[model samples]
Target: MTEMLVPTELLTGIAEMDGQHDRLFQEMLQVKNALLAVSDDDAHGLALLSRLADDLVRHYAWEEAAARRYGVPFADHAREHARMAAFVQAKIDEIERGVCNIPALMVFMERKFESHVAHFDLQLGLALQAARAARDAA
Candidate 1:
């Protein structure tokens, strides 16, 4: 059985962030599931990816702003966000060039996304919580 890409646990503990993560997973999983059902269907994959790309931008922007609000100077976190955006854009380019191997890309992305969220996202959530607590105590 293929591993589900969605993070099963609440990594961020922030309701909004957790919800956003679930939304991303749902969007991503939709494309992945489609790819799995119909292999090498570039048009379908591209269409889904195009929609997902827009959603990702909005989600990333929210996280970026949250990082700032939390006052967490986390360069790695920012880098990961940039990396994901660039990766999705690269996939878009590949599809446009008529050379997309979506299965491989899907597997790689899902694994990376799962781990990134389980670790970095969770850490960011903790940092945000700490910041909030400190602010409340102030």
Candidate 2:
């Protein structure tokens, strides 16, 4: 009876980023569960979704800032963040448009997270790790 949005094994070797990934996954899972629960209180579900959106915005911002600071030469990495932000916003909009299909949204999130982790998340994490090592040795 464990509810996890993204498996911990998906987290790469960066500590702060991995912690953020875990928190984001756990928060999204909580929101999905609350939305699917047989309860009359929809407020908690709404709040969690809002918080997720806010956290995503902040996380993306911080990630892009780090890339800039570290001089990561991958242009696709920043574009990936923009693409994901748009996708996530679109999902949130769909949910807010009187759609109660939490199951469908969860599926979409799972697919999105899988692709994102494999691509942009891992790239950023690896780049940051390299950057940190270089800085430490210098």
Candidate 1 lDDT over 1-138, as tens digits, reads 544334567457788888787777887888888766856655786788888888888987888899887788778888888998899899889878969787888888777778888868888889999999999999
What TM-score do all the candidates reach, one by one?
A: 0.84, 0.84
RMSD to the hidden true structure, all candidates:
3.7, 2.9
TM-score of 2: 0.84
Question: Alpha carbon lDDT of residue 135, candidate 2?
Answer: 99
- Candidate 2 per-residue lDDT over residues 9-43, each given as its tens digit: 57767767776777788877888888889987877
Which lDDT values do the candidates have, in the order given? Answer: 0.81, 0.77
Identify the runs in model 2 with alpha carbons over 4 angstroms from their true place. 1-9
